[model samples]
Target: MTIRTAFKSMSVAELTRKLASAETASLLLALVEMTGDTAPLDRWGKWIQGPTPINAEFPTAEAEEIRAQVADLLIERGAQTERLSEDSERFRALTAAATDRVIPDAEKPLVLKEMGLLDEAFVDWSAVRPDRADQFPVVIIGAGMSGIATAIHLERMGIPFVVLDKNDEVGGTWLVNTYPGCGVDIASHYFSFSFAPKSDWSRYYAKQPEILAYLKDIVRTFGIGEKIEFRTTVQSVSYEEATQEWVLEIRTGDGPARTMRAKVVVSGVGALSTPSVPELPGRGEFRGKVCHSAEWDPTIDVTGKKVVLVGNGASANQIGPAIAPDVERLTVLQRSPQWVNGVTGYLDSVPEDEKWVLSNIPAYERWFRVRTMLSMNDVMRPAATVDKNWDGPEGTINEANEKLRERLIGYMRSELGERQDLLDQMVPDFPPMMKRMLRDNGWCRMFRRPTVELVTGAASRFTENGIVDEHGREHEADIIIFATGFTAARMLSSYEVVGRDGVSIRDVWGEEDPRAYLGLTVTGFPNLFILYGPNTNIGVGGSIFFQAEAQSTCIARLIRDMIERGASSAEVRQDVFEDYNRRLDQEMETLIWSLPVGTTWYRNSKGRVTANMPWTSADYWNMTRSTSLDDFVVRYHDDERGTAHADDIYRELDSDVARTH
Candidate 1:
């Protein structure tokens, strides 16, 4: 039996004894977080209340054991998990400045001693350029993490910026996905921004409520909410060549339209916002209630209903196992198979004692988080490169691909004992990491349930009652779920912004592909910035927070430089943007995402892989550290008409909107 199964069956004393083993501690914690009675997750309510006070301390031996276990896991992964040398004077200088961002003073002594923080080296962007300080008014679209993060850095620089969001709420993706098992695959320790860490996360992998609350808290704590205009969708932006300003038209919630102008426009409307429902026949004829996973219906009754889930991407990977038990009959429609990596459990709440230690011990949790960032976040980016010799059936590369295959295959054998047919149907022919790997430690086990059915080779064409799969089989489902992913390559789909001589952005790129220099600004579009833009998605496995933070820092520096230079606009030189994209395309030629053999959403019809980036998060971070005028065309102007990026974007709502009767 799996350790998880044994954990579920253990008694209170027996469980505590099992948890005493450092190897099983995280597993036991996962079990408790999911099913424990000592502390309930829902009871914590909303909002980040700041660092959890460590009322009690663990025995030194026990605490050290936990740290050792984490280290072992990193070693097992063959990651760049080694720390900076403590004896190095250079390391001390870096750490001293990074203290505010990465180190916790209370936990520093023990943490630094064990983790070797002082001697460890870091590239402090703050140090590289003290002359890099520049400021400008900035316009940011989309009020998600990417937008808020940009605002955070701008605020620290005392630079003014505003964020415009079409949605009524601030927590972009988190605000939409309310599924049962919806949470992060990456550990929360590494998932957050280093400058504003949340030491009080209830679970290692934080759930939706906790993450949403964190975003809300950041907004409140940083006073970022004051910079956002809610329920305002940006519809077409235009640039005046004579004035060098962006005139953006915004539609209010009640339908009143107005124009706002800014020095630069940045779009943060993330890739996954617009979901792609497959172009299948009779899709409109599903009589009963149906919705995409992103647009989950909280009030809709899935209980005792015949449910059908299509596509096994990240969304399907999560929802399939979660709703299997609650519904009467559940069918997962698979067109193509995907390799699922071993479920790293982190959905549970953090233990009160551990939470306390994390908050009180200065360097302890912060150092641990840095390790988690390197191990869980940055480590796996390289394996995404396709090996030419990997001419196998398809899938993952190197040792990573092999180990993941073994873990998942073992899980399958354990889950489906008597039915080899079911196991084969569930398994994929490809190697791991070729595409994204999903985590559902509970998935295979849930397959054992009699109520669930895994339908393989379901090349679906929507039918009246439900779906008609390839083998002429008709599955009648009360509800249909279109987890068909999203339109990822088509960046900035909405606003038709005319820049510099009435050149519309759509006319410049067409439907073929969207290209940007460092995924921030376009050549023709001067002073326009994008967060989580085209070719910026972590083509490999990494924390989105890291990418967002990096992009935020990049843009913040750009604004700072403009203010200091007193420049009106800095547009990417055409040749510079083209050369950068050429090298980028060359780098992508060897990546798995460029595979022409597979039918992946990563590739567009034109054979351009515009959605995913080929480099590591660290590499991207180093590239975006600062803005150089050599990379752009710096426009000089001393006119009263010139404005900052955010000035004309957001506006305050009426007293009635804030009023409660």
Candidate 2:
């Protein structure tokens, strides 16, 4: 049954029971949206208070009273009402109550868009579409979350597009990374797209298989599977100024290389595709099997075999605990300690009643998503901000960061009761939010196991049947798993991109330190867009899916504007690009990632924070919400070069709409 049908058919008693399992703040918000009643907010607003208001604990009697009121309101007024409240005042009030903070007037639109209440990303192609729009087709690389989102936008706009993937299936990283204990550290609700939400996720934090299944289901639901060219690798993309097209060289499954052309190219190939294994001496001499975490070989069983894992990062934190019980001996080589937060239900599944509320209630899922977005995105941002006047001891960046460090240390001490040795090895010497925070998935408890050992040092070399550490100590092993992460500093390193004036992107970006305007377009690359590009990775707050959506929306608007103006190509001005990067660098200095913390992939070799975005997700969203032609140098098919005024183009499109109707 449809959600509307399910919601209408729900009985009061059943709804009350399901609402009892739902988050109080989200339940109240959903009820207010459905019934246009702000009474519940005043009644239960005091109970909703915290960074994560959804997790707020209320008195037992008061909680039941709130649920009963919500049920009565839903049955009496919400089910009968067709038009919900669209008032700005009501929206601001509801959002403030749910988030436990004031929602500024300027930020209300962004918040509404995040709650899935507004469809700002939609473009009216019928009125603004150029006569030759059909001639300009788009080519999107990598059929992952970003590529799929871009394709869906193009499909809705009635634009011609093709999706290419190097794998045989969708889910780029999810399809490849099948290591043991592989799962998302972020909440499942926040990790999903706002447009296409999955309310029935099995776990609060989903695993690889389930997340991959969700992506595949999205592909099928949107009919995007037919438009994907699987097993096709784009080797290089060269822009041709003569024809105003991008020539893509691709190869398919051992097939000969072929050429294809498109008016626009969107690089959805994210920073984490290629694996980065450290160059250790005598690695070939080791007799044991070696494999990176991304390239896991399931057939190679570690049952009762000695295993030595390298690089105790995010993947290692999960992999060590997962394989500790099955393996005879597990040794983890750590270069530095990471700050891992202990989550209560890190491995627990979502309850059935909660899923029912999410699936059956009218606006419960949206409100729940909004709460998660607020809690996970910007609420924790203060802890990552640098304070130059901080007087705290070493390892802390600011007062907020020091408080977080203390809480994390207290949790670690409690987990490792008498094992101070392990606790010492696990406690990081840097701030809490410097690196990506990992969720505790039995990582601390695994250290208490007799068979598991934590080696504190880097691997210097490898022997015939063992690995040697920096201190010249050898650890025997039958298998060597490199949890060493990806080459995140190098954006789009898998393929070559030659832009205007025969300038290679590699030459411009060098080995690392990629700079982009709004993390979307480059200076010399005309009609090219990059999703999840440099300075786009979230270090402390927000979800990658949200970033992907923001970028895809901006790209769609740019393409739409190009067609509306009858422009052959559009490139960001060199001055605009440099100015953006200059501001981004200044902002970077205020973030924790720019501090001299332990070694992290967030920073490049030049000590610049190249991978992480310094702005809040809402800030980036507002910045990319619209495109201005004044920022780019536009050229027509007849070789006429000039920038079009946004006002003139909009007026012309409005006139066209009036004439057509």
Candidate 3:
């Protein structure tokens, strides 16, 4: 039923029940803030004092009647009737009351931007018009989250650009990683782009197919399909110093290679694209069906077969519970344990009434998204900070870390009951959030099953028919699933990138560690920007979509500035790049990931924390909001040649968007 009439069908008791929910309470607080109607909030008594615990229910019939009245009033005065400015006092009050934390006025702006409450302040055409926009074309490397967002904004500004991807589809990680029980860890609402909200999420944490559908819908809605080149791979990117242009060599499938030149290049190939497979001693002669989690083969069924799943990280944690029931016997080879949280709505579906409210309300979706984002972002930050004076166990960084460790242990104990062996294997020795924490996907319950076996020791080597652990025990298995994670530390492995003076990115960054200026621009790569680069991935909270959008907007602005000023190329200064990396490294030393030193994908071979950003998501957003011209050396058209490229009215191959240079 539609939202307008859905409310009319609800009885008073049902409405009261809906109102009693914590989601309803927080949403009502948002409603009151949006319209300045205190009637609904006043009806709740002191229940709205802080973040209402999910267990809190309406006490008496009188309270139910008041809540029903508020619901009726809300339906009568629809959200479309009024709009709330994010900077207003009422909005701040709503934020604080809904979040159950006092946010200072100084931090509101950053919060607003991170929450997507602020306006699109990235581009200002009035200050610097896109006069030479058509002449200067841009080439975006991927058609994923970052690429799509960049395309959308560039389309809005009437800039000419082309999106190329190696896959036959979009959605990057969402498209590729399709193992059983695959889904987003963050709330689906906050996981999406802020400018575009989805009202039809099946659950709070959406599954992979639903998210892929969302991205496909975005492409259709924005009419970006005509400009995207699917099944096209960029082989190498070389900067032409003489012409001040980026020469990209691309090949589509097995077709012949072709070259395209653009004024600027943006790399949107995310970090987790490459799969990292361990080199087992007898992997080749195992004579069993072997597959990585990311590259799951649908044809190879594990029904009633002996399965040995390697790695107990995020992917392994998910795969074990999903395939254990059907398999004859499941052996989980664990190198180390992970701390998984039992979230409230992790397994629940989105109710009909919540969907109705979100669809019907104007500002309600934004406020709800902000509430979830704030809940995930900074609430657990303090637990990861190091207190210098306070001595703590080697397993934990500080007092707060130790307390969190105990709470997690308590949670594990409650779930597993007297199964000390399971607890010992499940709980990590290090503090929580040291690595990417896993969400509870029935991981503990899987251990209780008779068919499942949790092996604590690391896999020593592979045998002819099975695997051997470090303790010299052999377990025969028909199939081996490497739930081992991706090569996240290997940034931009899709293609070769050469910068000024013909220097390859691999030569500079070696095999693993990659450093970039602001995680967007490298020092020597002129006119080349990146999304989801080194030190940009969030550890504790925040969505990668949010980070990608921020980087896209920043790059778009810098490219616009160059196009407006008739500049041929712009490279981040070397000294500025070094100084920023130095500060970033120093800051990394203070984060929890650096302490209690565990082996994680977040660090490189040298033990440098390359994957996670040390600061809050808000800090990264503030740093990338705008570009400083002084930090870059821009080469104008005059430096490249006396005039622009001789070709006029250039048409991009396989593209509807054409440009005249």
Candidate 4:
């Protein structure tokens, strides 16, 4: 047998051991080594001797030449550098490394199992009621990632579904977020469909155009675009039990109104699409170009223009340093400092050879996908937790957060050089997990820019020309980008949802917080399944796509149960939903998102935690794999067959397969 045959025969542990010792990745790298094409990475000059540490220093005299070369490379690729650095080379390396490192060691089976990537997905895959055929029609709102993904599974089941979007085209967040510096923070390779892996990626962290292109590619590949009704916004959605369908009233941007009905309604509008502008005394009076980063106007030229970026969330963190290079002077106005942890693969781009391996090597792509998921979910899971018992500051959590703080501060001190004043202005006061933790190179590098100004104080009010700071300093600018972010605290609040007995979803969640049993179904909403619904957000921070897939699969099973039972809907038992939420809240209270100093969107006005799901991604996955009647009370349309669907939920299956789901 050839070496290929021998390598394939060894167990994963042995392969890993061989891989670790080789320095080269594996058989693939060895093949490249034989060709002598893989040069000593340093010769490329992509890396340099320590300015501080790895790559920063090039001989001082050569700095001008290198900087000019870096600029030329950046102009060719529309990518962010740390959102901090505009240089594409390092980010390219990270993307390359991420593609390599994304492959997991041992849990290919488990990762494949969770994602239904295995041949034996017969059990888990059967949860979607494809066999019920035309029993129910599914209507989806928002043609974004979550909605599109849900439709893909539904299509595989042969379930009739249509996707509606407010935009002129599909690609929800990816479609709308067309800002200059906008690109995905997640590695482009893994920030996509697990079912469909791409071997052709030009950038490690793809820009908006590339990200949008990926969506369009998926739409074409899956044949979902034809099912989508673009530029049609959902006006109102009312659930009707008599017919067991949703009354969807839609309004097109052209002023035409239409109505449709479907058994299931899924919202992929996402919690982040709507731009949340801060209420100020004088608004909209800016003479020059003013727009939210989400709704960026490409026509607005920032060259030589004084730009003022409001809000230092993810968008501003990226947009600030991104446009700063082109602008005359850029000023960033921050509300509260957000914790920005360093992410490894954000800048790394995958090489063509590695892409070839990921594509042709069978399990290579799957293992890499699993590895990225595990890196995001399993490895970083603990970082989101708050240890209240350990003695620390009111805002800061225990040793872990302190370590994160120190790590961030260390980076700040290094990046800031000798400027302690800038360091004091840059560091965050709130705990790590309070707000959505961002990973950006831009935040650190923003201060390093000579023309960039970092103002720590609050924006007291908006002036006719610029933003006025709390200390009475006016930030003069011709261009303003509101990176203030979205109203993520309010989930499902954008839609007009009327559940059983005319219970408004907004009214129900009024003044308190949003809660859902298993984060899939609500108690009052029977036959209604929500994907990426209330409290479903990963609190500790993981991929939402994982949660989306799990939730969609879990709900698909419930839908299957309802159809099998001859019932129109699935409803969580009031008590059961309440009890589950109680546990979730209890978990939240223990975490950092619950503390006094922890003022964030994760919590509501009443000091109740709202946005995040406190459980581990694995825990959430296992809990949602199948449904039990004990967790919910079902309803049948017929008066005589009341709650029959509840009984049918757990009909013991003859097949060992159904038992697992």
Candidate 5:
């Protein structure tokens, strides 16, 4: 029933068995918290040497011994003490000892908050009465991960809101991308929401079904399902400046489109929602069941069929290997090679014993999450930064970048073993992190299969039976699957967003190059927020869930501020929005993606880095930790403040600036 009661029921033998499978460092820190003893840290501190999850310097025997000691200590004193205290100094010391890295004073607060040791500052919903909150109705688009996260925050704040998704169910991307071998590249713990950590993930990197199940569980647990209107698509959102509300045109399951009103609108229809199927010459000529990876038709069987997979990005890496054994011939067409890092246990299921520790241990799950967060949070950022002085190869950015390149090459060589031809095709000419870094899912090994072939050319045209390459070589295929990623640069390309003065978001952003102040708000948009928007995608480190939570918190806080201040609308100041994007572009010039690396979705048609945030996760966290009222021009209701307008306030501020100058 209760966590403490459940944890107390575990015997010493069971605890020891489970602990043996757990990370030694996580166990040690959790033990310290559970037992109020620092003895385990002194004993095992030397064994932890790096920031990664694989930082255990001890041998297998020694690790088992440490687990045994921790189990005994937990059985002896864990139940008696309800976690020692919220001791920050002790936490900082224990974290350092556990991670074996110096936790900087500046970064400790963020680290603490991520670790669940410190709670993030949320709006005191009690400050705004329920009746007042109801006046500010919110409408969220897409019942995906970001949408679900935003809804949870609103639900917690007791704000009246409804989630609209085109799909029949939740789990936006996960629900849509049902291709074989669809799964997460990041570790299961890190990919999930920090607040709703799943202790019993089936695999180290969970597949689609499990991921979807997890999201559905969260919806049920938080009671977010009833508030969600599934099979409902938001066609357009137009801001009503006169009434300070958003007018939404939505369609439910082929029904007649209807209009609704909301005080605020949040766009969670992420960049990855729309599949980017390239328009090749003679695409209609192909006489086969062609499908994009995202819109995979499950009924179409690939067994004994010659399959042509276009694009060797994250999705193709998984799909190629998964179908290689079953398909008669698996031809992977590549425009350019992606930098893939080999992760140990990429396909390994989480051991039952390990799950036991995560589920039952007092502070083990939190510490384990912290370990993963610390390990992944900007670990490869140094490799992504350009070092202009040091001269290396064309692909290498800096010393760290070159080192990563060499290490990855070594991994490919090892995996391909004697297959020099395959290794040559696998390595990319651009620097690491220029494109999304993929996790090795037997992609290198799949090439060794007799039935599999890696074609190093783009599709020139589609024949009646197959596709012709750039060199005019035809590859016969019974089925063609486009693993060609999504329209990521074009944010909110699905629906129309009409902001102030009837200016369309599409008109402002064009085909791509969407910019938002802090990737949450735009200058013309009032009481509107974007989650997983422009420049919010984590390129080198962190997950989208992290960005979503931070952005949701920021939006929630801003809405709360509006409710408390009795404001009709809150729009980001033009100067603030322009200044933020200017700084973002300036920072983008220093990142690896800005270099003339071959075409990547991270960059827009204008050759600007539009998809990824130039800053580290911690940097973004600090920037969005709180909303600055000064950055936005808040417009009060006509009754609250007679005839005061946002435009009038901006002009007055501009006049004051002119006089000061």
Candidate 6:
């Protein structure tokens, strides 16, 4: 039966079930929006009231007309959405409808990139000549989300490249983090890479196994697995000034180190590689199973055993609720409470029919993903901006921030019910978005359970059997799980990098405060590109996948230009680097993440915001759309001389020679 005929025969209950599914919510919402019918929306509103109103009926006379209209519209528009163009009426209408803003003509390119409306390429494939492809050999570090993206783009350009990852698998963070209830906080569709969109996600928020399986599947499908060298670690990269090549020292699984060469080196080593273990005194004295959330020990059994989970953060939040029911007693030690945002469809699985609609419908998945992308990231951004006029206390930063705080606190209170102490412990004093916004995941409900206890204090030290609080209270445990997050500030601290004249990256960025131009290129480090670098983490509202894709395209364009122009190396000038960083620092001073209300991993030890970008994902995408050669100094191997520029030359001696005093 046809879609229209099939829907016409369905009962109201069946129709409601179809509409209420996570996969169909966006499509139904879009239809209701397009029709401007409030009845369908009201019915949807009731559906969000959850299981009680799942059988809600559409009360509008326009219901049948709208459904048929939506079906016809999907069939027609889905066939025409083959290319990226703002001129497409459906594209423009969908864009305006999804964003609820007028997108100017000039902004269409950026919007298209952000929406994955076009093929993943910053430069045309025809622009890259075949002969030069072999000459532009590239090496990418890490085979995670960003690494594979870079490799895929480079391979498309016919550039020979190698992917090196320390782990024995494709997924970087996903491979290591096996804690129970581990899953992406972002919606599954938006969390994935734009070029390889998936329609058959089992869960709305996919779990670790599903995510890893997806990445591994991508690697297998794209044949990226052949180019990847697993269990191989990149130790250090030094620039050989004469050959203009990056000399990489690699160690593979306890073997002796070996050196390799590549004209370009891209580091996709993300910020979360190194796990941050808290410096609790006598930690080594604990005579029990000790493990961090990232390095979860599946061998250790937690059934009917007392567990002490230190650090109340994202990992702790997910781990707590998953293990709370099975453990005899659970203690969650927190230094400070975090603001948790409750998502409605957090625990729901995608239905088979909805998945079929997504996979079969041509542009349905893209538009739905576009709608979800805006909802997940763009909507919460304004709250991350500081409002100078309105005066508020530590609980919030602005009017928007205040409204969010009130809503979140109300959620906690409602979840806690009669347990006011748990509510008090869960309500955060700092503004939202300052730290990572955690998913509620029934965390407050977990605290209300009789088997669980929430302790708000610094962990002083570990005794022979358990952890001790600062107040001299001891919490005994069978296993100690450190949910403490990664060392975010140290982006590439473990590896050594020598640039021009033996200048190390540490020497430029210091031990902890690493800075980069556009969070992609570094000054004096010729042909070295980085993804997920300093100031690139979007805490406000965006995925690192978007950032990584943009950066990969940017890096690819730079390499293409270098090969086409016959340039030996291109490096960001010192002045441009300083100017970009200066503007970033100034802009960050006005954002909520940089406020002095509380501390987050987004900032460095010196209280500077290092890991987060100040701009929106769209802005960053625009900035990296193409590389401007004016910002960098291009060098040639045959010239045997450097170009004379104001920033390149030290004119102190020249000034003294010309002095007439």
For model 5, how does the per-residue alpha-carbon lDDT over 1-661 read when each residue is reduced to its tens digit? 1244444567878777777788877877776766666776777778788756667657777778778777676666563334333455567567677575786766767766665545673445533353578799999998999889889988988889999999999999989989999999878887887777788898988999999999999999989999999899888999987798999999999799999999999999988889989888888888998999999998889999999999999999989888999999998889888888898788999998888778766487877887788778888899999898969887898999999999999988888865777887789888888888889999888888888888999888899999988888999999999998898988988899999899999888887979999998898888889989899888887877788788888888778766655567888988889999999999999888898768888898878888899988888888997456667888866754643433454443434332431
Candidate 6: lDDT over CA atoms?
Answer: 0.77
Q: Which number leads on TM-score?
A: 2
Cα miss at 257, model 6 (Å)? 1.2
lDDT score, candidate 1, position 405:
75
- TM-scores, each model vs. reference: 0.77, 0.95, 0.91, 0.80, 0.94, 0.88
Provide the RMSD of all predictions against the true structure, rounded to 1 decimal: 12.2, 2.5, 5.3, 10.5, 4.2, 6.9
Write candidate 1's Cα lDDT for 153-221 as tens digits: 766666557788877889989888887678888878777766667877888788888999999888998
The candidate scoring highest on lDDT is: 2
Instruction: Write the candidate numbers in order of decreasing TM-score.
Output: 2, 5, 3, 6, 4, 1
Q: lDDT for model 1, on a 0 to 1 scale?
A: 0.65
Task: Give candidate 4's whole-model lDDT.
Answer: 0.64
Candidate 6 lDDT, tens digit per residue, 531-645? 8998998787767778878888888877876665556688998888999999999899888878776779888888889888888777788788744655788876765566533
User: Which parts of model 4 are misplaced by more than 4 Å?
Assistant: 1-109, 114-116, 119-132, 392-395, 628-630, 648-661
Candidate 3 lDDT over 607-636, as tens digits, reads 888898887887787788745545787666
Name the better of 1 and 4 by lDDT. Answer: 1
Candidate 5 overall lDDT versus native: 0.82
Scored against the true structure, residue 408 in model 6 reaches a CA lDDT of 88
C-alpha local distance difference test of each model: 0.65, 0.83, 0.77, 0.64, 0.82, 0.77
The reply for model 1, stretches above 4 Å from the true place, is 1-136, 389-400, 458-464, 638-661
- Candidate 4 TM-score to native: 0.80
Q: Which whole-number lDDT from 0 to 100 does residue 182 have in model 2?
A: 96
Q: Which residue runs does candidate 5 get wrong by more than 4 Å?
A: 1-11, 60-62, 79-87, 126-130, 639-661
